[model samples]
Target: MTHPLVKRYNLAPHPEGGFYRQVFRSENETSSYIHGETRPALTHIYFLLLKGKVSRFHRVLHDEVWNHYEGAPLQLFQLHQQQLWERRIGGQGNEYAEVVNAGNYQAAQSMGEYSLVGCTVAPGFDFADFSFIEEPAMKQWLDIAHPDLAKFI
Candidate 1:
């Protein structure tokens, strides 16, 4: 069955997996203090994950803040600075909002039936600044940094 969020937002298939719709993109532009890439000041989007679907490991040049809206919780995994970390978002034990820093490889999956969440990116989100990590690379990194999370990737 189609998730309500997908219908409500008219979400489309995301390359990483799941579904998403770009909801807001600021017209303001600025050079990234970290990456030095020029982009919008802020960008917002609705992201939805259904059971059995995952947002594959990927990285964005800007910091992203995720806000929980409704439905199931999500587990967000990040690989950064040679370390692996996982954070829960939108569940009883999780924070309603969480941040994934710039340059960190991040991914997420629903913990139950479905999850509807929003993501805001500082310095905006651009396809040129997005990158998906290859499976072998992710496996090797996970094996060393977070062996327990290897199965998810």
Candidate 2:
């Protein structure tokens, strides 16, 4: 089936060194994002995968819940006490589960989905959640891409 255009989300940097992202319809995995700091009560994130799956390899700085809006299926996992505990939350094992304390977990091709919504507390989520985790340390790219979001820090 023909899908929507793949989005190119790019955050800009500030004079000093920080990052920020535009707030837009998360479902619109095509083209859009708002400027300035946005803490949405329910910020939905859509992952348009080139392959059939997507990898959200990182940690949820703030406790959040994910609802699979659209995709093949989802395998949610988390790092609790430095241990990996996984489960097939989308198949027969369970249905519509929320991952907790997700840190350094590789949801690689396993994280199958084109879109998912991460609901957080009011005034919304900041950089703590935008971690493009490559390894142990956070790359801290947003700080250089969109300093505006980092300004809040």
Q: In every candidate, how many clashes are there?
A: 0, 14
lDDT of each: 0.86, 0.40
In candidate 1, stretches whose alpha carbon ends up further than 4 angstroms from where it belongs are: 135-138, 143-152
Best model number under lDDT? 1
Per-prediction RMSD in angstroms? Answer: 2.1, 11.9
TM-score of model 2 (CA atoms): 0.46
Task: State the displacement of the C-alpha of residue 78, model 1, in Å, after optimal TM-score superposition.
Answer: 1.1
Tens digits of lDDT, candidate 1, 42-82: 99999998998888888998899999999899889888766
Window of ten residues with lowest summed lDDT in model 1: 144-153
* Top TM-score hit: 1
Write model 2 residue lDDT over 1-153, tens digit each, in one string: 333423244433312122223343333222113333444544434333323434444554444555444444455444444354555544444666564542333342334434332233222444545454444223254345434333222
